[model samples]
Target: MNKNQPTRPDGTRDFSPEVMAKRNYILQTIRAVYQRYGFLPLETPAMENLDVLTGKYGDEGDQLIFKILNSGDFLKDLPADAVTSMGSKKMASKIAGKALRYDLTVPFARYVVMNRGTLTFPFKRYQIQPVWRGDRPQKGRYREFYQCDADVVGTDSLLCEAEIILMINEVLGKLGVQNFQVKINHRQILNGIAEAIGAMDKFSDICVGIDKLDKIGLDKVMQELADRGVSGESIAQLKPILAFEGNLQEKLTYLTTLFENSPNGQKGLADMRAITQMLNSFAQAKDFPTDLHIDFDLTLARGLSYYTGAIFEVKVEGVQVGSISGGGRYDDLTGAFGVPDLPGVGFSFGIDRLYDALEELNLFPAEATVATQILMIGFDEASFAYCLPYLYELRQAGFATELYPTVEKKIKKPMSYANNRGIPFAVLAGSDEMQVGEFSVKNMLSGEQQRVKAGELKTFFATK
Candidate 1:
């Protein structure tokens, strides 16, 4: 790459108009589903006070937050002698006071804490915005990408968790995702496994390692735990739990016995049972089919320490990408900010990953990419002038209508533009047709042409 050449930053992308259309299609589908579930829209600033985001997502997540340098001479505050010798950690603390949010959930907790008095109870809100991270980029991952999230706070109902499962299915179903699985587990259950194995003090370390199980494999995860100071004896006890296999009921029964002396484990098991029962009733009432794709995995730890209860991860089959969506229940996320005991549950759809999955499966509908519905072409100046009012009328009637900017002697130029844009219809008119107060409407797909009076263009497209 030339040094002087303009380029997008690595791990970011410039979306073409066509790509934007497809992305908007996905966003609209998600927004619609969120609205149907009674979630209102919300937005937060791109940068937050660094402290607000720092300790919320656990150590691994905290490291990925994109910090913003202080404005003007950032090093002025450092002592002259210490500036040259300060450690990286100390320098970072002194120089950066703001950072891009790592995710929506933490900032949301802060928001609830700040605005608790003015907000309604059990507030349900949805946010669609771009979040920045310092993560390594890959096929489905990016340094900057949009997260479409819907969350409900101020309630501890397991019904919220069940409804989230239903919304996950509905969003994917509407987006034409054919095969996907929503993997769910409870943080309490993970905690129980830690307790039963006698590694309760190292729970967070264990979670951070187990969360990498799918990516790093079991042997590597055990090694990571040992590196994090987990005992060999605890690892031995945890192996069978991590490798537990059975149907959902059997998994629940297995946990019931393992959690006999663990309160967190028992509560987690009861929550799972209540959530699943509500899900069945909700599905039956809504006439939503059950595919049994929602699975219970003993090793499913979501790494984020904030997730206190149910956690979810949605994976699409046949796509070489990571989970397209994930979130969990946070009973006291707001407590850190002085608002205690507010329980909330939510999930976010990784729009970029979902876009990748849909593209891989060729699931995007033809209409999703269509921008202009009709392009009007003129053989000469008079016909072109005549198209101006019809353009206004067609647009007034809710058609995406465009008239060629100038008359061209060669007909192929305008036709080619329409074809390249996937415009389905074209109106062709010459001096003769304009003189008769009529236009030629051509179906670009069938190449079929019809002559209609100027007053009838709207009605003509109305049928289409």
Candidate 2:
């Protein structure tokens, strides 16, 4: 690595102001929706005790954690033979005690447990922060990304699940995402499917394989299931359930019959039915927009070990990107932290993926990319000085305004600068306008000019 060379880590990125503006747009939309639903904002540290995150997310997730090496000669006290013989995995545990958080849910659970004595029951909180993972970076995945999560803890009500679904619909709808579906499923349903097929003990193996169905296709998923030692007979029985397709009610009806012999499956089906009914009733009562679609997807095994009940995933209709958001119900997430019996349900919007989708669809508002709404151009030192107050006032009036730094810069230079930066309006405060207390405002987009009194500049730009 050359000292003179500038670079970002391979899996990380630098968000330029324009990109940040768009990112903020998505985050603000999510935050507003979360707040509207009575969820309070909360934040947790970026790093946690390695023990805290280790066993939470299944085996694959554990491998992706970015562990931090212990500071101050971590190996000083280790036995030389132990270091030589112990595998890297075992050695890492001895040397590293802290790791960057992989997701918000675990940390939130930790927070609730630590604060359980002071906080009220059914705590509704939202967290907008970056999480780290050491996974290979690609188009939609990153080592560092933001997860906008809203969770309601300390309650096991089905209404919490329903409310989360509605929140997902509201956030995406408000963001102008035209084509997307909320795919709902259940862990118990997945377990029931496994049991129905006689793969009761291979539940995780079955889910790990089936969860890849969308990415690797049916044949590959079935092959993976076989490779995992699932019997051919079991695979045959599982195929149709994975292949089942219909409206929410139709799918539920079919699943009801399929899981009839499996108690877990029946319970999952019943839960799914109740949630869908409640959602439908809520939609009908409120006359919800038609753009939001909710479907029961039996194959939506979210792959996380913590999801004890309903699981949700949001996917764009016409794009090939991965799920833009996902989450589920965790019945005892707080139990690991000594606060057992506190159930919670929530979802996290992948800000990066959502931004990519919005950008691909050109859904961002026009103003999102504009850095400055108006630029103040000064012809001379006196004119520049004169324009300072007006510039301050424009900004004070809530317009993104800036004054050209140097008075000696030519008119064409400032105009071109404004044009290149996508600044919509430029205020010319040369000697003529400076003396009369009026300014010439040029519309950079249309090349039209208008004269406005200095005091009325804010109103003029506001209207424009």
Candidate 3:
């Protein structure tokens, strides 16, 4: 490859047709599940006001937002000192007023706040769109990728949370992800832990450090807390909580006593219990995955600061990748936009990582990548013209049919095209076949050829 050749920017990708087909398979599965749960489709602008995105994603996330430079003379309005001496942060605010959205949830909150009066209460909406993050590119992480999100606003019902869990099971199962754990935690639980450890003032630091417990070990996390100004005494107190382990009931019992004096912790425990109880009832009465383990992980603190209630992160076993999906309840996300009292809970499916996992596991079905059922090839112009009506008829009969472009004198060219594209069937139309009032249909896989009349093409492919 020449160095001078123009290339795609780092951290982004150009998806070929084959990759897109499999991606669409994942998207369709998620969309169907969302619709089954009664979520209407929604879309928001790709760019949001810089202020709307800046303070929402925490300090680390704010750094990853891709800002758009102001058009025209952006610096013309700034003072000479402001233009030359201001730090990057201050200059950024003055120079860039818009940025690509970091995630769908914040923009959804902005949308709900703007359209509150015209919308129904408890609005259930699903948004599947690309997001941009200016982080270093790595396997399963991208600067530009799509998120499939489903959310319910205007209600604080724990049922929404329960339903979200059920949907998680359904969506992953449908996508053929066999071994995955839906790790659940709550913000108040972390708060209670902070209070128990006397690190109340350092709750955010604690959550951020704890979120890395899986990647970095507990000792490092404790050291990080200390480095972040957490008390040595508090670190000692939190060690036991970090090492605590048990079944769901056992963990709940332990936390109940630990948080007995903490009302926020108690509230979190109540919500967790209620949501699990609902899930259990469904398992007993309906078609639920009996083996689905709701792992109550204390260290699963999603780094997003907006999550005010339950937080969730799903890890796929047997795959060396990050969480494939995550989300949580936000009691006042819309409130940030001046619409208070609209509590909501939701989750997002990270399609890019999910695709990687599925591809690695070889779970995508063969039919998922089949773009065309048949390709019609002709050896001459008249023969190609003859395939036009047949192409129309096959498509009308609900078959994905396509006429091979160009007029090739030899069968080698068209046959190579069909074989390379994995097109299952090919209809060969020549003067002889047209004269006989029939077409030569060949199965590209088996090399089985059969002469079928024009009227019988539909039935012929249908039976195959």
Best by TM-score: 3
Instruction: Look at candidate 3 and give me any clashing residue pairs.
Output: none
Write model 3 residue lDDT over 1-464, tens digit each, in one string: 79799989898999899999999999999999999999999999999999999988778899999999999999887888885688888899999999999999989989998898899989999999999999999877889999999999989999998888888888899988889999999999999999888889999999999999989999999999999999999999999998999988999999999998899899999999999888878778765577774799999998847889999888899987789889999888677778788888999998888998898899999888878899999889999999999899999999998898899767898789888988899999999999988999999889989899988999998998
> RMSD of each candidate?
2.5, 2.4, 2.0
- In angstroms, give how far residue 34 of model 1 lies from its true place: 1.5
RMSD of 2: 2.4
TM accuracy, model 2 = 0.92
- For model 2, give the 10-residue run with minimal summed lDDT: 283-292
**Evaluation by lDDT, superior candidate among 1 and 3:** 3
TM-score of each: 0.91, 0.92, 0.94
Candidate 1: misplaced stretches above 4 Å?
A: 1-4, 57-63, 69-82, 85-97
> What shift in Å separates residue 95 of candidate 1 from its native position after superposition?
5.7
Clash-forming residue pairs, model 2? none
**By TM-score, highest first, what's the ranking?**
3, 2, 1
**Poorly placed runs, candidate 3 (over 4 Å):** 1-4, 73-82, 85-95
| Cα-based lDDT at residue 78, candidate 2 | 78
